[model samples]
Target: METVFIVAAVIIALLLLSLVLVKQGHIGVVTRFGKYHRMMSPGIHFKFPFIDNVFNKISIQHRSIELEFEAISLDQASVNFKSLILFSAKNSDEDTIKKIAFRFIDEKSFMQTLIRSIEGSIRAFVATKRQSEILVLRQEIVDAVKDHLEDSLNHWGFHLLDLQINDISFDEAIMRSMSQVVSSNNMKAAAENEAQAQYLIKTRAAEAEARSIRVKAEAERDALELKGVGNALFREQVATGLAKAGTIMDAGAVDPALMLYTQWLDTMKNVAAHSHGNILSFDGSNDGFDKTFKQMQLINKSLLEKNTH
Candidate 1:
């Protein structure tokens, strides 16, 4: 009876050792006598008691880590970055699981390698770029790191799901200098805009003034033309009146010279009456009086000849 009870107790212990439970989001790696045996899914798994070992249970779920590091730019400026990295196992396949389990001695070693590799990749990229270009090249930096780290991460049975460069910063002095540069540029732009607006206003004013001057000149020209026409009509009417008066005086048995002299005297009297502050100077000698009389007799004679013809 003692031998029977001891054998049953050993069987029960073996059964307990053989049962392995892999929880959700986890996969189990089994090894037989220090050699790889098989993979276990997330459930109750049966194994050979005392023969197979559960080496490591790797979680296949997504994981994340934050990184902060410094890099030197091509211009030899120190740049700091805060980044986030999201990663996970490539897949739950046996080949991928093997690489994840055997790539490093432990989780700490793997994490160290991953973080160092990311840092190295970022440093390499930063070493080729200028400090001024770092902020704008955030996406490019991420792409370069991805392309550079794809095969390396794959070799370790992990995928680089996402990489984010959240903050890029420079030294305090460099930041202040950049801010001053931006301010000066903004001031220059504003000054140029103001100058352009003033120039436009001046140009419009000059154009309007020129247009007004042109319209005034045209109006003056039209008024002069009308005045010249009126003067020509008045001269024609005066000549007609002189011819009619000379004919009437000749038919009345009066000397035509008398009528002409009388008309000249009346013209002088009217000029004297209506002259405001204007001077009416003439040759007042005997030669001037005879010359005026002769001119008046010639005018009457010309009118007489016209009537006879």
Candidate 2:
């Protein structure tokens, strides 16, 4: 009874050891005595006990990694870059799985090679471009890296799904210089616009002032012409009235001197009552004030001669 139980327990242990359970999304590569044997899919799989080794499990699902690096441009500018790369197992074929299992010593080695290949390709492309051209050539850089790395990745049983250049920048000094250039351009544009606005405002004001002056001159000319007509009419009426008064006074045999003296006294009373501040200054021109001055002089001489008599 003890011998039979020992044999069954040994057989159960070997059975358990031979059963390999692969997880989802992973493809398992089996090796026999340190040599390639077969590939196993997800689920429980059986292999020769103690002979077949589950060498490596490769994921067929997409994998992504972010990379940050620096490179030099053609003009010796230090350019910094952050990128995202997506890759996966080439396919679930026997050859592809075998290649994936035996390509490199381990996953770390394979990833290092892949990263170096991408970086080297990018640096090579950047070496031919100036610093100013790098931002605009993001797509070109991606394409070049893909083209340079596609075949190599395929040989290792991997597919380069996508390569995205996320952020590209320059060193601090270079970035500051570029920013200043843009700022200066904007300032120049603003200054030009402000100058144009000021010019328009001044021009409009000058035009309005010129128009106002022309209208004022026209109005003054019209007023002066009308005033001349009124002055002539007033002088004619005054002369006619004085002539009638003189004729009436002579017919009635009234003293013309007494009449003149009364008229002078009445004129003085009217001036004293109506003049502002009881003070009046003549214009001193030959138009009206100079003639009034001469008439006053003749009256003063007449008054003096009468008093002397």
Candidate 3:
């Protein structure tokens, strides 16, 4: 019975000694004989009672570090720049985090060094580029720095997620000058655009007006040509009719006195049929047409009688 109780107690102590609680989002590295044996993931884990040792525990979490400082340009101008760096440990094991904890400084130290290096690089970049280019290529400079830092720090078991410039402060005078230049450029572009729009509108309006005038002139010319053709046709018809009448008269098929007497009888018949009352007609200033007719008849009768005798 005593031997069984001692055996049970020893088993309980060994079990207790072999058990280890690893938290969530963490990994534990076990080492044996001062060398890496295996890595244990989160939750309860077991190890040999005396042979295995827990070396280090590491977190698998992404982290961020912010840094801000001033840098001087090649032109002796002070620039205030602030940046944020996102980084994470590539390995999250007991041994790796332990090594990192002892061999590597904290995030703040790393961020300071990173910011200093980035500032130096930006300075060199700005020296080669104009101030305008610097402003335009600020993102490029940031990316370059991030790439360089990631490459350098990857060996140190760290991965750079990103590095970005939050703000860049310039000298007041330089800022004002830049603002003025931008304002002037915008104003010039606006004026040029306005001028171009005005020119296009005027050109279109002039073209439309010219087309309208041309159409009106063409219509007037066509109307005048039509009118001239009509007038020429009427004059030709009148001339042709007059020529035919003259030819008929010259042919002597009908006497001139007979034509005059026919026309006079037709005129007197039309006037009598349409008259409202009796009309006393006169020949020019003669008192009556009857008296004029009597005179004409007497002259005709005398001529006729002379011919007969």
Candidate 4:
């Protein structure tokens, strides 16, 4: 029984020593005779007991790291910038990742190296550019970093996913000055707009006044012309009426005295028709209406006899 137990223990120990397991999304590097033999995928894997070794395990998964750096502007002004970088192993080559992993003990040291490279490149980029250029083309800087990192780190099995610039802080004085200048420019523009508005309003008012004066003058001129036309027409009508009256007189062949007496008699008849029984005081020598009527009839009859002769 003692010999069987010892044999069982030896078998178990040999089984444990020869077996290797790799999880999902992971690959194992198997070394034989102290040299790379082949790669093992996720599952139970076998290796020579003492000659073959599981050198490294590499994961084909996404990873990210944050990076920060300081930059100096064109005016020798310093600025602080921070960003995040997301990367993943595109190639599942365990040898390549193992080489990279061996250079740096862990993910943090590898990230530190990447951060230093990024910072150096970004600072160089910013140092060559002016503050205005940096402010205008920040996206261009990010693109450049992404392109460079993707190209440089690809051999290390890292595929760059994205680079994000989170925050940027400029020198206090420069920031304050930019703010002041922006505010002043806005105020100047506002004042210019107000002045232009006032000028337009005044100009429109002047034009309106000028138009009003012209209209008033035109109306006055039209009224005077109309009055002159009316006066001429009135004079012409009066002259025409007088000429018609003269024609009637000539047709009748009557003396002026008889015509006047006929008109007076017509007026008296009209007055009598309107006055029903009203008493009318007369200016006479107490002889009354009979005396006045007899005189008028005598005068009218004499004028008529002269016309007949």
lDDT of model number 3: 0.72
lDDT of 1 at 65: 87
TM-score of each: 0.68, 0.63, 0.64, 0.66
True lDDT of residue 135, candidate 4: 75
Q: Which stretches of candidate 4 lie over 4 Å from their true place?
A: 2-21, 48-50, 93-109, 208-246, 253-309
Better of 1 and 4 by TM-score: 1
**Sequence-dependent TM-score of model 3:** 0.64
Please report how far candidate 1 places residue 274 from its true position, in Å.
14
By TM-score, who's the top model here? Answer: 1
| Colliding residue pairs in candidate 1 | none
Candidate 3 lDDT by residue in tens digits, 132-229: 55666778878777666776666566677778888887889989988999999999999999999999999999999999999999999999999999
Misplaced by over 4 Å in model 3 are 1-20, 29-39, 46-56, 91-102, 105-120, 244-309
Q: What is the C-alpha lDDT of each candidate?
A: 0.91, 0.87, 0.72, 0.78
Q: Could you give the candidate ranking by lDDT, starting with the highest?
A: 1, 2, 4, 3
Q: Give residue 290's lDDT in candidate 3 (0 to 100).
A: 51
Q: Tens digit of lDDT per residue, candidate 1, span 61-82?
A: 9999899999999999999999
Write out the backbone clash pairs for model 2.
none
* Candidate numbers sorted by TM-score from highest down: 1, 4, 3, 2
Using lDDT as the measure, name the better of candidate 1 and candidate 3.
1
Instruction: Give a tens-digit lDDT track for model 4, residues 6-100.
Output: 99999999999999989998778777887778888889988879999887777777777776678997668787888888877777766565665
